[model samples]
Target: MSNLFVKDIVVSYSGLPIIDRLNISIPDHKITTIIGPNGCGKSTLLKTIARILKTDRGAVFLDGKAIQQLSTKKVAKRMAILPQSSEVPPGLTIFELVSYGRFPHQRGLGTLKLEDLKQIDWAIQVTGLSELKDRPVVALSGGQRQRVWIAMALAQDTDILILDEPTTYLDLAHQLDILLLLEKLNKEEERTIIMVLHDLNLASRFSHNMIAMKEGSIVAEGPPSKVMTSSTIQKVFDIDANLTICPFSTNPILHSYQLSGCTQDLLENANEG
Candidate 1:
């Protein structure tokens, strides 16, 4: 399978390393989720690979070509990225926002052509935003706004989609809504997806591959069955967890979890002191 390869990448902020010599191969046409605790460089790695952030060393390779060497428009034609927090303009309508995705293909003044309109409409329909095409993005609910951003990405018509914490700031139902939409896109359009996810259970359920990281280093990467073990979770997250296999789906499920030591024991020790 084709892969997006990161070779010896190093990223630093203020002379302190965030990601050090990180090497990973993200398989094409599959949903790959990166899971880790906060400040673990998951978002930084995604940004570097998407060329939104400059790498201090090494490079990201897309299909054997260095991503940095490619023109911005060239890269945009092949991949689209939706970052964690995107600031929208004051009053851009959903249709207008989605239409902006066609900029890379436009020759003059960034005006939408006939094909652009078709693509924007398709993106809106697929994301269930057809009725709200004229709605101001700032006025929409969180989930609706998220879908609008996703529709904009879809309108880019790229084979690879990279999202940083796509489900952030949403209720459980809305989170599932976005994830299910991504699964459908992957299955039907064969879009290769890479994302940073905070929820382990949801990541395991939807990801074809999972990369677990800690302290800017990858601890484990493989199918969820191989990487989502009790030991691996403890090692990567430093949290005690029970890993159970679901009888029906056979997927690894995180049972009950807590701090490694008992609360009662801590209280007893405190009283003794």
Candidate 2:
């Protein structure tokens, strides 16, 4: 188990800061979800942890070692990342796409070794894509395609997995399926799973730790019950909402309402009256 520590990370694009002096630690062997509004730097932070994006200041440490000092292959062997979207190579089958995960382990000629085959098989099995291995990637539905991408990332066989909005473009069932798969991977396989998720309720349900960010800063980080409160939601998302115990699960559930433009003025006038 290796902890991911982002110490005062700062990320910028085109001279504009996106993640500003953010610090967070992702515990090993747990599922951590980052939830925020669009463009809140969730994806940016994930990419920095994965070493896909260079940090402008500070450092990302994996197991107490600076990630930037590690070789690309070594980093790939320790951390696997599934970006929000990936280009689908023309005419590639699911099996072929998943086999690409072996790139980090290849020596010469990029041939798949016995170990690679075993890993690919296990990844496909875990993702339930064994039947679709031969199917062309472009021909599958959005959910099926997303599963294939996840299978590829799993084939990397890393201790840490970072997924950027994996549930995007997935239907309700597929979203649950992916979340459950991640939970199983974390609980049974002892893998650290970190993902950027938009659905707050799903994040609360599936994650062992929740990180709520706003404007490149973390608003709250803790277990869902403590971090998903009405005050935190309002502060992070600027929504007036009611928090209630979920009927079936006993978890905190947020119910928000649309605030009419005149409602505030009317309420203020009534207060004065």
Candidate 3:
């Protein structure tokens, strides 16, 4: 198992810091979720940790070696990152797209070795994409397309997987589908998973560790029981919410949110009049 560490990392945009001296440690073989409101630097931190964005200061280390010092192909062989959005090539089949993951492992002439072929097949099967292997990338539903991307990541055969909002733009059912698939990969295969998630409830239920951030700094970090308090929610998201234990997972769940200055008060006053 490989562990990732971020130490005092700073990422800036246009000379302003988006991720300001952020420090975090992702546990090996566990699911860690970064949660924060929009523009709070959750996704920026994830991308920086994955080495997609250059840090203005400090470093990210994978298994004690600075990530920037490693070769790109070397890092690709150990960790895979699925960004929030990607462009699909026209006329690319699902299998063809997934097979591209073997690029880092290919020798001269770029033939798929036997082990690589087996890994590709296993990735498709695990992601439930066998039936759609021959389908064109542009022809699939949103959920299926997301699975195709995950299959490609799985085909990379890396120990660590980093995703930015994997369930974004999906309906409730598709969101659950993607979360369940990631859960299975974490539990069954013991893969180290890190992602930025928008839904606090889903993050609480599925994550072994949750890091809550506000303005590029972490407000809390721990299991749901420790991190999902009402005070923390209010601090991190600027919303008043009630926290309760979930029945099935026994994790902290957000029971309700009270939006400040909502029109309900006006409606009540009008009714009284």
Candidate 4:
């Protein structure tokens, strides 16, 4: 499968730029997490990469072609995105919702072909929602609902999955529930997983690669040990942090953090830069 990457891309919102000529290549079959402070363009980058938002300049290339040049159905077959917030119509059954993912693969009046049923069944089974597939999505817990959405994406049968803040609004345990599922998808299915995450610790623990952004620019990008340094944390979020290796995973962990003394000054300097 071809990898997704952006080159010198500029993205704007409401006449203001959020990402300025940024570039990055997503490694195939790996879990990459984008981390940054609020308003730092993490979600903007993900949306642009997923083709949910347009870029003002340069290109987002997926499957070795400029994404904008491809049709929606063509793109959907190669990559799937789970946005930060999705509104599900009330009373929709989990099976019904996941069935929507088959739309990209549908043809000739959108009939549910045998292949479509197989994929849907696989998605529901892997997400551990087999028994609840007939239940209404509105009746499920937050974690279960998240799994339902993931099942929808999985049903898409794409090589790449881009998620914006996948763990937002989820409690601590549910957060792991989602991330662990993503990890499993990467390791077992060899799917490329990219996401925006606010929780630094979880991101560090789960991500094979991490990108740290500050004010619309990347401050650092690498494996957890390289990107989760005290300097990068302070520069990106204006928070002084203590870092150590996670003995179990051998990834860097944020031991503790507090506001940096030069928070205001760093912000001012970065804005000026």
Give the alpha-carbon lDDT of every model.
0.91, 0.88, 0.90, 0.90
Please give, for residues 195-223, the per-residue lDDT of candidate 4 as tens digits: 99999989999998999998888999999
**After superposing candidate 2, which stretches have Cα over 4 Å from the reference?**
246-250, 257-273
Supply every candidate's count of residue pairs whose N, Cα or C atoms clash at under 3 angstroms.
0, 0, 0, 0
Q: How many backbone clashes does candidate 2 have?
A: 0
Worst 10 residues of 3 by lDDT: 258-267
The better-scoring model by TM-score among 3 and 4 is 3
lDDT of 2 by residue, 1-273 (tens): 346889998999889999999999998889999998888888898899889889999999987888999888998998899998887987999999999998898888998889999999999999999988998999988888889989999999898999999999989999999988998889899999999999887888888899999999999999889988877887887765567666645667665433324547766997999
- Per-residue lDDT tens digits of candidate 3, residues 166-261? 999899999999999999999998999999999999999999999999999999998989999988988888777878888878999998887634
RMSD of each: 3.0, 3.3, 2.3, 5.4
Model 1, residue 83: what's the lDDT?
A: 93
Cα TM-score per model: 0.94, 0.92, 0.94, 0.93
Could you tell which candidate, 1 or 3, scores higher by lDDT? Answer: 1
